[model samples]
Target: MLLELIEYHWAEDIDEVLLLLGRLDVKTVPLAGGTYLLGLHDDSIESVVDLRDLDLAYISEDARGIHIGAMTTLQQMVDSPLLKELFAGLLARAAKNSSSSRLIRNSATIGGTIATGSASQADLLTALAVLDAEVVVRSGSKTQVDLKGGSYEHPGLALAGVVYKGKHERRIPSGEVQLSRRPAELIIEVVIPRPTLAVGTALMRVSRTPADVSLLHAAALIEIDAHTYRKVHLALGGSNMEPVRLYGVEQMLEGQPVMNPLNSQKLLTILQEGMATFRPPADIRASSSYRRVSGMGLAYRALEEAMNVASWQNVMSSERGS
Candidate 1:
């Protein structure tokens, strides 16, 4: 129980929420799903401004991409048909991997996931990264924070802005999430742009058990031009402090041929060299060397999956055109 609990305010709108947040002391915070907030017994927290009453929950799209409200639950995103079609269900797949229990997923809000920086380990972060997702933050005005190197907190209430790619864009953006100081005051929105090319994306993870967090995981999105890879997006997590894009490896494979089975060995070598600097932790899950080796294997497999999917997509598109 919160021994320091002093007050609970249920805000009706963003304005009221913002006003309440502006008056907060160190002991105050905004509450959303309460999945993460209520579980904490920190003595420093004296009050919680409940945001449930505010109309912050939503799942919509614009010409750019899909926009998910701060209050939107992981279960909501997983059930979104638009999201499934936009990135070939990558978001839904990652959301499923975010939490195993249906009850927990039903209660966890997107804002909470991002504010707590849980995205670092959540498969959703890697999926969003590949889609070039960004966080929309609002205080008095809205500020679009790119996911790459994005970490900020509003002094009072803030809004989330998520900008996604449209169906005609090629380049995917990147972003990052971190633990914030005043998440209650910040409005959080996640935006992900749709890839415009014929691309295939896949997610692969390795863990001690199905319910355990990933120890070494990788995700890939590859755009194919005939048999050549025109564009590649690759990310790896759970093998380091935070998930990171394999920019060097991506560069090497951007224009390379992957349809040939013989290239597998060469591609694996390139991936290993690219991750040569990676130093995974030796823990109960696996040894450091095992994690490193397995991470590379996962990356390679993810790429192969993506390639197969892209090839299928290309063939289907051709059939439709003909």
Candidate 2:
């Protein structure tokens, strides 16, 4: 809980929120869902600027992709018709698997999830990474940052919205970064681009329990041309604070044929080799060795599932044409 002496301020618009954050004497931040704020017992915080009255919660979609409001809750995301229709309901699926309990899902906001920088373990983040999502931030004006490796949490800065791009020729390589626990900024919304072609996405998580934190999580997005992979994106969490991309693995698999089980077997070797250099953190949830070993399994499985999905979709399309 915040200090008894702390001051509460309600903002009706972005201008008012920024003004409060710019104050010199008071340490302030915009409070969205308060899931993260309540967890913070920092004495340094003197006040909180409530964004509830700002009317930021929104979700919209178009040919380009979906636009998600920063204040949208995980539960809301799970219930979004737009998300359910696009990418075979990938965003909704990920949201369903996030933070097990309904109470937390009801309170946790997507903006808070991304802004907190704990996305390395967030199911929603893993899915977003696979989809090449981007976040819009507003300080005084507006700017867009790639969500794959973006962070915001400065005074007067907040995430305005997110953009998911429609599938195009642009290839989003997979990689992960360490996440920061400190609140950096407010996320207003998220945007996901639509794939130019038929793309298959899959999310996999390995946790100690169904409701517990993920020890290893993997997300895969694949587009195939005939028997060859036209594009591939592999993202991971539990190995780092933010989702890490499997660059070497993606490079090796690009344009490769998946008809042969041998191809996936070969990828398993490459994936293990690529991860050998990095050391995963060890804690009570899982030891370093367990995370690495299990993580590799989840990654391989995700890729395989993605390939299978692409194959099925391709077959269905051909059948329709015929």
lDDT of each: 0.73, 0.72
TM-score of model 2 (CA atoms): 0.81
Q: Give lDDT tens digits, candidate 2, residues 1-322.
A: 6774378888888776765665768888778788777777778888888888777788897887778887898999899887887776778988888788889889888877776655325687778887888766554333455443334653444445564322111212212212322233344667777664467778898877888777778889988887788888888776234676777778878887766444656777878876665556776667878877777888888988887877777777778878
Report the C-alpha displacement of residue 195, candidate 1, in angstroms: 2.0
- Identify the runs in model 2 with alpha carbons over 4 angstroms from their true place: 119-121, 141-185, 260-264
Mark the 10 consecutive residues where model 1 has the least summed lDDT: 165-174
Q: What would the per-residue lDDT of candidate 1 be over residues 1-322, giving only the tens digit for each residue?
A: 6778888988786766655555646466778777777777688878778878777789898888788888888899889897777656778888888778789788888777766653325677777777677777554333354444334753434445655421111221334445333343465577776575477899999887898788877888988787778888888776233567888888888887756544777878888878778776666656888877788889889888887888778778778878
Model 1 scores a TM of 0.80
| TM-score against truth, every candidate | 0.80, 0.81
* Global lDDT of model 2: 0.72
